[model samples]
Target: MTQCHEDRVTGALSVTGNAGGLFHLRDGAVIAVESAGSPGVETLLLSSGGISAEDWDAALVESVGTGSLQAALVARGSIGLAEVEAVAVAALQDGAFAVAAGDVQECVVVSDSADVPLLPVTGGVAPALLLAETAGRLDAIASLPVPLSPYRDRVVPGRATKSMSGERREIVAHATGRRSARDIAFATGRSLHSVTVEISRMLGEELLEIAPPATAFSFSHWGLPSLRPRAPGQSSGKEMDWTTTPWPPNCGRSERTSPE
Candidate 1:
């Protein structure tokens, strides 16, 4: 696969209108497009076959007829099913074309041009396809009205901030072992930037320790000793020897006995 760095600010893939090209995101994630195409005119999404990135690109170009739907994929890399769903919902709300693919669900196609939903595959579609579809839908729907009015003005809304913090905590709790930044981001509902920033802050403050590969930190390995109480009246110099005295009435005890 031909790998090249895209702009970090936009998180977009830089590619010419050609076949067999790869785009690397700012988070060190790489996506190889099977071919180059426009956004809304052609099939924007292509399934990434279990092959080399170069082969994947060539297959996509051959399948889609031309390079009309490649820009969208370059903009957005492969996304999860949940993220695809979110994009689809947003796209449908705005009266635009949207597509979705899931591990268990078939490929979904929703568009203003089509009356019925289209399913390319029966069983499931790959993540790369889903991401491409989402990007295409987003591009098609960009002109429509999005229901982001309430969130458009806030620096960081209260609910969003709280949710982010909770997600971070959950990520940290489950980050017992050495996991990649991308994996943590995928697990914790956070972005790659957010995960990296939080990890850096934690490491600098000595609150978290990083282990390479599969190493993990266990709670039981902290080496703190357990505490236990001493027996009553075990000292000889103590004056309070009331163990023989009668217990309080109705104190759930019929009699009292010494330690012997």
Candidate 2:
């Protein structure tokens, strides 16, 4: 979240890393965040069985039909309002985490006269809150033994558990000595913090063993969805598909009292 001085970015802040991303902040609050590594809200919902793929597609259609995805899903009884909020929050945190790991480049700003791209917005998350949650995740993972950072560390099945089932068992089973903690989180549709905390404990109990780290989620390997540019005649307020948009779309703009 470092910027020139304590100033918020005027446009898109491009970050380069294993998962390069664009962070858009307005009035110091993030509106839309796209990350090359983080899973989309749709992926989380479908993965967690919050909604089936078919239901997700139906929701999309419903969104276009109703002009609001949030309303369509809830109105159709596809998911509760709270679940939608949870998905947005998780996507925001994961996206922020990826951006934080990267070296932020100079941000690109749009001219006042130019039309800003109307990209889909997940939710507005305060940058400070995102950073705080990320720091908490780091500290939780830091409590573990050597070479575990949750994002990169891979774990393998060590000793069998006492037939326990929960986050701990889920993590140990997937620890395949290959998948990173992020991977486990996606597979289980749980938050990274919850997964990593269990991982630390499992490691302590010898239920999981650290594997020689493999190339975790890297920028090159991270799959970003394809974004179709809006037609030239498209209105800026028209809805855009949130999933297909790449990271670094128009994030947010601040109402600066004074120009930088």
Name the best candidate (by TM-score).
2
TM-score of each predicted structure versus truth: 0.25, 0.64
Residues forming the 10-long window of minimal summed lDDT in candidate 1: 147-156
Top-lDDT structure, candidate number: 2
Q: What stretches of model 2 exceed 4 Å from their correct place?
A: 1-11, 65-67, 101-123, 145-147, 213-260
Those runs of model 1 whose alpha carbons end farther than 4 Å from true positions after fitting are 1-164, 212-260
Evaluated against the true structure, the overall lDDT of model 1 is 0.31
What is the per-residue lDDT of model 1 for residues 19-78, given as tens digits with 9 covering 90 to 100?
Answer: 112222222222222112112111112211212355335545654654322332332355
Residue lDDT tens for model 2, 11-97: 555566655666666545565566655666677667777777887778778776567777766776868888877777767676776
lDDT of 2 at 114: 29
